[model samples]
Target: MDETAHALGASRTLWELVGRRAGLTPDRPVLLQGDRTLTFGELRDGAERAAAGLYGMGVRPGSVVAWQLPTRIETVLLSFALARLGAVQSPVIPFYRDREVGFALRESRADFFAVPGTWRGHDHTAMAERLGARGVFEVYGTLPDGNPGVLPPPPADGTAVRWIYWTSGTTSDPKGVLHTDRSLIAGGSCLAHALQLTSDDVGSMAFPFAHIGGPDYLVMLLLYGFPAVLFEQFAMETALPEYRRHGVTVAGGSTAFYSMFLTEQRKVPGQRLVPTLRLLAGGGAPKPPEVYHAVVREMGVQLTHGYGMTEVPMITMGAPDDTAENLATTEGRPPAGMEIRIVDPEGKPLPAGADGEVRLRGEAVCQGYADPAHAADVFDADGFLITGDVGHLRETGHLVLTGRMKDIIIRKGENISAKEIEDLLHQHPAVADAAVIGLPDPERGERVCAVVERRPGTDDLTLTSMSAFLRGEGLSVHKLPEQLEVVDALPRNDALRKVLKYRLRELYG
Candidate 1:
């Protein structure tokens, strides 16, 4: 990071960071949408006005406010206003309906709720009313405005738990992960440092701003004094114009995003998809080596994948200057002060290069879950957060994630990493995407199943052909998939488009 950004990242609170950046570059654009641009001065001044407006509505310091708004400049203003008031804010994904929204409001005991009215054909205000939400209000393109004189002093303490982000509730009810301002700033700082971005770079927020990544990317922008284009609804075709319009230099959300851009590039083989684009960086799902190679070779861009979760927003990130072998095969090294330990099943620390559960200790780690019931299983006795992810730290300090603990397929007491088989399957020309899952088998306890999405116009892939390909790739016989199912498209979440494995298991099992 540059000297100015390094100084800005030291600001105690999110509001303080905003103030520092605004003071330095008041007129520079911080956020850009269709035709609207919000400068740093506007962000700070607008947030203060909104803070006073919220104060008029009975929102005070420590009051819990929940919002389910889309990725717009208004959303950023409201969130920062809450920060200025020192209120505990709970940000719910706009795509979440009654169930998840109700759960968050009830669990957080929110004193106020903000909705986008009707977004993407869904009446969020009506749904909020149905759930009996308190202090429900609409903040689509407008926000409550009042004189800054009505607002009290901004928050000074950065360690207080002031943020609650929910996990994607695919299988069950969502869990509210707690975070403080300092932790979030730390997460964003590490990410900004690793990517080595500067003020000259124009970024894009293609994912939901309500996700944990929202503050992460925002802090990077604040620290670097750069602007990012916001996409309320992101699709490759729809977002391409915005990318070109704003001259987006750094773009990506996850592996799925890279693949989507690659698909677009394939249409016009030699032409640059987004002429100004140079780097693709993101984390949230596993990145296959083949995807990394394809993005670099075909799209002519540097693809830097990272490893992170809701609990810790930026664990490890691939740098732009990393070696090809390291970038393709491993997630980059953790930032300074972020300690990564690979531990065996018994919780003993394993040597470097040993595959084990990854544990982390860092300033960026979340304090704990909102529900104390879920906290016990999240940390080890040593105080490191037990990231159910299975991975190893190489001697070179790179992280090599194999798969999640739950993703392991145990067939007749032998463990098989679904990622290992999926990675190999991704190399198949006829296969566009694949998810390997284990289904119950009466005789063998569990049988390996491969669910695939065929490439367009490619020949159908059968179990016979897949097995032969796996064998030729040197996969063991026992690890070979016993079943194969092809689907037109794999189920994915709205934010990052990670393959929903649980959904596949429910559908195919």
Candidate 2:
């Protein structure tokens, strides 16, 4: 049988056939908060209503709708609502000041929108009022006066356009990753099996609802007849209680998020939450070494270090219970069914261990970017999604991320990769966070500099200390930074906590 039928037989796509199981375990909790609870049947009812509402508004399949929401119950409902109507979802990670939001709105060409009047203390409704679309639903406050009835009916086979994720742009032009019903069902099914998701598991999510991972979790949980728990913020204080309250079995967060959680527990390790958590994995960015060490030893949660892009999330993931060396040292073997290849600039596949641009081919890979022009530069001749990232596949089948092809820094005649320097600095315990950027230099043309965020209350990180640490690690004197700027925090895009290299270039350039 074909993949689509296979997925249906396996009961994937929670919004599709996935919800048929909803009535099977009606009384069982479908969603849970400290005091709030929604059974599987209840959530299904709300989803039907939301779908009906959007349908009533005339949204058809392939309609692009953007959602700017915090981690909340409504976000999940809105997502399934769009899915029920078979319209595409364009989720923007929250609180992007007016400029970023405006860019996403205009670039995505969104037709309908659902945002909070004000979310997390920002006036999203007021900001979005200018959008003036056919339908607007606000949750943090009010969506305004416009109210459409129910959503349109689900589209026919192969017609659903699910998501349009925005990626960091090159040359100041943002790209929107577009996926079809085929990809979402295929990808979600891939995750359902890969993460070992089942009806019994409940996930505690710290990522934003607008992000692929957040909604991915939501869909996966519902796909398997499981529940999703949300935390408004990723604070350990709040996350812990929610985990205990909701009986959370799986929890997700970025590696940097884990680092912050570790930082928060410096005073008392026993006070930390997330005790019953069975599966503890991370994605969005490479895991810092220290964060990996703590998860295994301190928190006792297995860490699955995942490497993926918005174009195709979870291309590779380090399995939990794998050696700490595997999770920390390399982004482990590709998850089941996903494929990875390293290619030269000309797109020829490279031998194992050769660092070249990483291209991914999988059922999960997106069809194209919303901007056709950007999509032109994103695919290989055979249709593999060119993920701009550079890495190598070891003979052992493990993938090690080297850096970005575009992040090459040229200092005088020396060509340096910023990721190399940043990876070196991350090994230092004093270095909680670090980013490297190339700055214009009259003499060298472009020289590399390091900006580091130290552990909170660590007053001992000095230029000399950092240099000595690098020297001890046998880093080349040439590779050593001429400057080390200490920062309280690194600028981060909403879902990804990776070093905002773009912000670094802007600041230093």
Candidate 3:
């Protein structure tokens, strides 16, 4: 371990880490977007100016500010500015519309909301106005700037809840998961340590900056003093050039990203997609073993996947040096500070190799959800977070995720709540009962499948029609079911008349 890197990681707050990294490597490039680059020193200076501007606009410590911006250099600057002010910030996914955006703003009680105006043909500012969002401001091309001297002292405490991240609601509204600077740092530390990166290793952020992985990846850059290319909109052809230009040594966001790269790699057989690329690493969705083997075989790069969520940005990550079998099959091992426990239905600890619920306890875990009632249900008696994921720990310390207890489907690395779709399906006049389950998919990781019981005298409910109905109900395009099955009745357990989703999976998987 580098002593200076270790000391810098011990910084109290995100702003502190920024300052320390800037001091250590002021001239080293930290963020690269297109032809532009922001050095570590520029990151610190720009954030301070933005913070001053935010302060001039009346943003103070603990002020709730929300942003729905793309993965851009300005977005990173704005977020760090919020950190500099100790403002509680909420980041909404760029693709999320009025439904999710409204919920997040209302739940976080955001006093201010920053948007990119009209972006990619979507009128974000107009939509913000339509949603009656507070403090709506445009932050594209240019950002708020003022004298750094006008700003108040940076936040001293790193333990304060400064971030509210939303989880895709399974049966209800999205839950606001609270996080602190320390937690974010801890999560990023795990990722940096596991990857064994050096200052020379270039990375790429193909995912949304609003995603939890944003801070987690940034922390790695800060720790190792390496630069990363940012992609505002990532596609194989367009993104490849940026990766090549920046010489991105590490890339990938999830299983979907892996497949995308693989598809691009297949465009021309017996050729490397990017000469400098060496590793394809990501989490947030299950990485099929075959995908791992394919990437290693064809792309000639190490592919390491991990397990993470909104509550805990990084619980475990596959190390680059791990055994190929472990890398392909397991979600890797937790770092020194993380504790992974397999528990029975009653919450008793299960021995290694026993498949059970996956529970986690670590500094990286978020403080809890903003809603106290929801938080109460998520944490176990011993303060371990009940992840709602079913997995078993190997004696070798790696974790094997089997399934999830939550009624949510992960499709192409995005969480789509089955209950949300099922509720919508129940509203259809032709549907007497509905159950939504995720079926194994080669390309998508999992594809949403709706199995419905048709009402008496109703027939001819097709997948296309069902999807159209869902779209009419305001469901996101990603959440629309790709496969539909009209059945006589749904399988129900003997108790409580609950639809057995596992049975549906068995029948349709």
Best by lDDT: 3
TM-score of 2: 0.75
Encode model 1's per-residue lDDT on 1-509: one tens digit a residue.
88999998889999999999999999999999999999999999999999999999999999999999999999999999999999999999787666568889999999999999989888988989999999999998799999889888899999999999887322235678899999999999999999999899999998889989999999999999999999998888989999999999999987667878888999999999999999999877656688889999998999998988788999999999999999998989999979999999999999998999999999999998898888788888888998778989999999998766655664533446687788889999999999988776533436799999999999999999999998887565767899999999999999999999889878877
In model 1, how large is the Cα lDDT of residue 47? 95
lDDT (Cα, tens digit) per residue for candidate 2, span 52-156: 666666667778888888766777777776776777788887745454567778888788877777655667777788655435667652222222253444555
RMSD for all candidates, in order, please.
11.0, 11.1, 1.4
Q: In order, what lDDT does every prediction score? A: 0.89, 0.68, 0.91
- The estimated TM-scores of all candidates read 0.82, 0.75, 0.97
lDDT of 3 by residue, 71-103 (tens): 999999999999999999999989888778898
Q: Point out where model 3 deviates above 4 Å.
A: none
**What TM-score quantifies how close candidate 3 is to the native fold?**
0.97
Q: Residue 364, candidate 1: how far off, in angstroms?
A: 0.3
**Clash counts for all predictions:** 0, 12, 0
